[model samples]
Target: MQFTSEVIIATYNKPDYLRLCLKSIAEQSQRPTSICLADDGSDARIDPVIEAFREAHPDLPLRRSWHEDQGFRKSVALNRAIAGSTCDYLVFLDDDVILHPEALARHFSCATRGRYLTGSLIRLDADLTGRLLEAQSYGWAEGRLAGWTPKGRSQWLKSMPFPSGVMALFDRLSPVAPNFQGACASVWRDDVLRVNGFEGNMSYGGLDKEIGVRLRNAGIRGRHVRYTAPAYHLDHGRSYADQKVKSANRAYILALRKSGETRAVNGIAELDAV
Candidate 1:
């Protein structure tokens, strides 16, 4: 069965990465049902980058959701997209991650009804990221990673996005718990609403994990599709990640775990209440 999907690209002020990110989407073997630019109040600079993507790939369905520059309200922006998206499945991507040609195809295939699929990211050092961002016509980094040096052989292996034919070989148990990673994860729209969507009252850290744990509480288990749907995460400074807020978020999530809370207190439903 073919499931309809929408790709939600969460972005702030990074226009260069956004440009390449969109390019990677454009190169997908299977195009999404639609694409939503989940803009968290970026400046006017990002408009041109978005416009260029639209003009270049006019056939792809695209739209944008924006709120004022109110610090790190990514959860709020994502919730807005989740509320607005018209698709059976939602694939979340960060602005800095570039996709494999078959990434979307893999996600669509792996999206089952009972569970959300979580994919991993191969972190690129800043030097390598800079090199690729500067290089033109190279957003799809599948076979080109041969000469590039990642941390080790294990890390380098992740850069290779295995084609669909060999997927069954790696269907063994996942090493890590299937957690919801923001960069590359897919879930049913119904499941998200069932848990009231992402917690709007959150900071940069632990927000994604909070929703993941909630989904588990709500009986939506997670599946690791890390190897099959792998993507390259670009390295960047985390000036926005405040340590105080990070600690607070960790405490909040721990409370949720202890209480086994499901729905988000300040989520999509709360947004409608105001």
Candidate 2:
């Protein structure tokens, strides 16, 4: 049976990256039911880009849920998208990550009812990222053939042929860990709501893992899909990453883990209450 899923691309003001991301999604073999742009207070420049994308992909249902430019409130923007989405499943992606054509298909095939899937991305160098952004074609082969380096573990799985059964075996044997990466991940909407969504207080760094910790505390397991549903992450300087804020967020998450905290203080409930 097929499940209804939506792709939520959390983005700021990078229209160049967003354009490539949207194009990749549009080229997916197993397209999502809809695509939602979870804009975290970007400027007016993003308006025409999104409109053009929507107009070009007339068959794809594209919508935006935006908030005022109130700093890096990605957690809040994602919560807004979750609240607005009508799909049963959600595939989360950052604007800079360009997915493989089979990325969604792989995710859908591996999706489990009671668990969330955490995937990985190969980081593309600045030079390649620039070339891809300039080119209109969403050809992932160009990057792969050009030898983009995989950033994390299990990236070698990208080259493996489908139906290898390695992913299933890995999921069964792997231990549940708090490595929730928001770059390329998919989860059931109900499961996310159960943990009250991501902590709104988090600044950067450990925010994604914080949600994973809460999910684990709530008895929701995370399946490692790192190699199975891989994407290419564009390399760019992180202007929002503050080391002090990241350290604080990490400390908060560690404390929650030790205390066995299952729900976030500022999360979906607060959003719903508003």
Candidate 3:
């Protein structure tokens, strides 16, 4: 079955990274129906970046949903994007993650009903990320093995194209369970609506995992797409990541998971009811 997909990118004030992200999206082999930029709270600088991208790719549907930059309210911004989207499937990306040309196509091919796909990103070191951003060009393939080295069980799958049979075999036998990394993952729109979207109260840290747990509790399974849909992740400082807040959020998510709570109290439902 063919599924319509939309890419929803959550951003703050990273215009350079966002520009690269959009450029990667523009190069997708199987482009999304639309791109919804979920701006948490950014200044006016992001406007020209989006405008330039729109002018460059007029055929690609792009929409921006912005709110005041009160704090790191990523969940609220994502909730707004989810509420605004009109597609069968939703791919969530971070501002610093640049996709491979085949990333979206692979994700769509691996997509199954009642399940979400969690992919991985190869981290690009500070120097490489800076050079690429400064050059305003994305040579993802050339820099595939630039900063880090891939090891472990699935190391052979890095930056290699496999036949359809191999992809199917890997998708079936892969031992990795679905752990939602907001940087690269895809889920169905109905499933997200079923859980009322993400919890707005969450700050960071286990925020994505909370929704993954809830989705599993609601009977949706997690599919691992680590090598199949790998992307390039631009490295940056995490100055805004508050350890205390993340700890509290993780504890709250654990409590909710233990209680088997599926729907978030202040998620998409609350926003829609308003």
Give lDDT per model, in order. Answer: 0.84, 0.82, 0.84
lDDT of 1 at 177: 80
Write down the worst ten-residue block by lDDT for model 1: 139-148
In TM-score terms, candidate 1 sits at 0.93
Stretches of candidate 1 off by over 4 Å are 139-147, 161-168
Best of the candidates, TM-score? 1
* Candidate with more favorable, higher lDDT: 2 or 3: 3
Sorted on TM-score, highest at the top, how do the candidates line up?
Answer: 1, 3, 2
- Per-residue lDDT, model 1, residue 69, is 91
Taking the tens digit of each residue's C-alpha lDDT, what string does model 1 give over 167-236?
A: 4345345467878998899899999999999999898898888999999998899887776776888779
Q: How far is candidate 1 from the true structure (C-alpha RMSD, Å)?
A: 1.9
lDDT, candidate 1, residue 42?
94
TM-score of each: 0.93, 0.91, 0.92
Q: Distance from true position, residue 71, model 1, in Å?
A: 0.8
Model 2 / residue 195 / CA error / Å: 0.9
